[model samples]
Target: MNWKDIPGLDGVESPGLLIDADAVQQNIDRMIEIVGGPDHVDRLFPHVKTHKIPEITRMQVDAGITKFKAATLSEAQMAATAGAREVLIAHQLVGPKVDRLATLIDDFPNTQFAVLVDDPHAADAINQKCGDAENPLDAYIDIDCGMHRTGILLGNPSDALRAHLDSLSGLRYAGLHVYDGHLHDPDLQVRTEKVKEILGKVARHEQQHPSPRVIVGGSPTFGIWAAETSWHCSPGTTLLWDFGYGNAHPDLPMTVAAALISRVISKPGEGKICIDLGHKSISAEMPLEKRFQFPDLPDAQPIGQSEEHLVLQTPNAASLHVGDIVIAIPRHICPTVALHSHATVVRGGRVTGERWRVTARDR
Candidate 1:
């Protein structure tokens, strides 16, 4: 059996997520390697939003990755519970989440928790929530490089926000969190140049503000930031590589560790077959055809998908019978992992019957 193929896949349930433990370990090694080595492991602050499994967090912790970046409060809490020394909730907190952040800080005294603040309103809110605590919450200024998704703009806006944060009673200015997720050009040279440009702007801002630390880049620019010794690199998708990233970023040698198990449910027509896999199981953010890939039926065309059914048009569909198992590699693994409560663990090309819960899957 191929390394990607599960040995006892027939025994496993359909429309389930499968995690290759060996491949995960290999990817972890590759991540540490990209960031230099064991000596430079402290520079690796991996994002926990990808896997969302506390077991994987523990694996990273055991491998000497003490720091983590999370997109949600639950992810941050899961990382803290998994023995992370430091966990940063990378998203800006709002609503009653401010109180939750305070509670998380109080709940995990051993772990240092930080969050991103792009405005004074957010800073003051955090201050009001946890200002009087014995240890105030550490805050990082989220700089919007070009994504414009979050973070303050590079120049006056960021400077003003920094000064405002200094005046806040609760949130302390720790550093800058620059995520250039927008610089995902297929060409490494193009991406590198873009990263350099973003860093140049950040350098000028840091010169004025004197930030103590900095965390930069996601999976696309991971290698570039890894070369920069001063900045911390947070790449989440490297843990469980997906077809979307792997195909676009061939320079990254990370393996696709996660896959989906589905079975033929019906033969609707001569050239069409329906599978148990559907939008509810895998991440459907991409186009219908690009959502998942069938290694067994490489030429399979994903014609339609419903809540619990995916119809495929493939000449090879005639060869497959009802109840026959098929494996699919998700193009987007993060949200796909969240759709499932647990992932069936595979080791050495065999199903281990052990399942790892997606601990922080829910917001």
Candidate 2:
């Protein structure tokens, strides 16, 4: 359906988000094809954190996705409620919210739940809680490949800690969770080599333990991940597509499916055009100036941005005026999406429909 076919495009407000459903579907199909063929459905577990909306998750499920990778308990719950049979909490579940994890485990009885643990203390807590339950909880050893953010070091895959957890009757050793956050590096060659090296270490660890039911890998390293390294690939941004990934591989099947639609709120000076979207609406973490592919206006540059404003400078800024709507593709999709509540699904230059409740907003 085209954007003009939607019910509320004319009267709807600006400084909002627009999602191209057609583009999104194409992306899903492309990624599925890349991982293997239709028969390899279990091999692709799209991360739900990218497009937190359940409707989108359902779409992915209908497309033969049984497994999902979520960053939080909320995301896991959302995916479960939306019909995801298997869900992986790609991060550690700690703190007083342990009850929440238990509640989810009780609620989604048929669903398989697994959480990543890099420390023995965290694993003990999870094991203690699950020990009392009838069904055991699945746990993965998150390895710190290169991104020193969450996982255990390569040399110390926390084997001793994993063994400790194995001794507990409540927790089952699922597999490895290796995410190369650094692989999205600007240099394609460097990123590819790093991913290969990291996955090689994971391969070695897997050989030693040989019994993990699931081997998972996150990040948009689809082009780099060896076909045999991972049993399932969890790529979030690859589904939605974004300016950051677009910059590195222009020909990638995924398009900028979502864009921050804003109107020219002000024209401060010659060659300077300001919009109403800023850090609050669009993500300032990646910065649009460093990322955006403006085929329509090649010379336009994001000079500065604030909480609710975007300053753009260009030689042809004189052509722009107030009330003119401008669609700014975000540098990063995850955080940029969190800033808005809903997204207008568009196609062929018109609003075809609307997707409400960008769901995974809660901390």
Candidate 3:
């Protein structure tokens, strides 16, 4: 989109992260609407790892989000400080991270903290630590429904592992947590079918040994899980959607909340101009076309990128000159948000004086 079209970024410097508060609120409301509103918002454990800012967490909490899932100790700390009723560190913490988490549990007594455990050895170590400190820890077996990454397989062997973990001291066995990020089909029905397949496995597991909760979904299939089942849904990218999710799933009613404000720095050749933004400004994880897209400059195509320069080849290149600002929406908002240290907050289509720290960026 054009710089003029985006609110609160009239005079902002180039290569900056601009966040629309109104758009974020709309995304949150959309999630709530999908998950059955306030009474069931707790079932939506929206991951805070997407936006590490405590202010955003507060906005979510004020909007009736009671549970959160974070991938780092820093994000979990922010969630706990935001007065979340429960926070799950969905990643395994090792070395210093473990100690920091222990401190977090002690410091934030009001927030019940949990961690994902796939290895019995790590569970033993954590159990030893928490048992020594006399502070019991809540643990969930990260079940691997399909993704071969961390987590025990969802069958017989897992039952034995769950029983072993429950027997361990200072480690309370909660339900299961699965991140089905691989289920990203353009067709909503295909996504829903995959969710149902996973849900069936989850149902059988719950029946054999009922845990207090089971958190599933990872942005793509959150709504599917919500529709077919009552389990907790964990969708982070919906908060600050990008072209990747929005373009793939048009049915999900979410707005683009995060955008990169950049300026043209040079006009080197015919039909070509370079922007201040590059791989450093946005996420490089996606494919070339999906990295970042300029909605307003539809003819402007990202030809190449480096650390600090995004070369654009467009027919309208001659219409632009040096110092012309443009807005770019990331194809993947989560990692793109991590690339910045601060976010420029805009409210009601007006720029606010406040700048929010991507508090957990370093962590």
Among all candidates shown, the one with the greatest TM-score? 1
Q: Compose the digit string of candidate 1's lDDT tens values, residues 71-116.
A: 9999999999999999999999999998898898889989999988
Model 3 misplaced stretches (Cα beyond 4 Å): 1-3, 132-135
In model 1, state the lDDT of residue 75: 97
User: Residue 300 of model 3: what lDDT?
Assistant: 81
Question: Where does candidate 2 clash, by residue pair?
Answer: 3-350, 3-351, 3-352, 4-350
Off by over 4 Å in 2: 1-10, 155-157, 185-189, 226-230, 250-252, 291-295, 347-349
The number of the candidate with the highest lDDT is: 1
The local distance difference test score of model 3 is 0.84
Worst 10 residues of 2 by lDDT: 1-10
lDDT of 3 by residue, 171-275 (tens): 888878888978899998888888888888889878978888888988888788888888899999888888888889897888888888898999989999999
Query: Between prediction 1 and prediction 2, which has the larger lDDT?
Result: 1
Candidate 3: minimum summed lDDT over ten consecutive residues — where?
A: 1-10
TM-score list, all predictions = 0.97, 0.91, 0.96
RMSD of each: 1.3, 2.7, 1.6
Alpha-carbon lDDT of model 2: 0.75
**Rank order by TM-score, top first?**
1, 3, 2
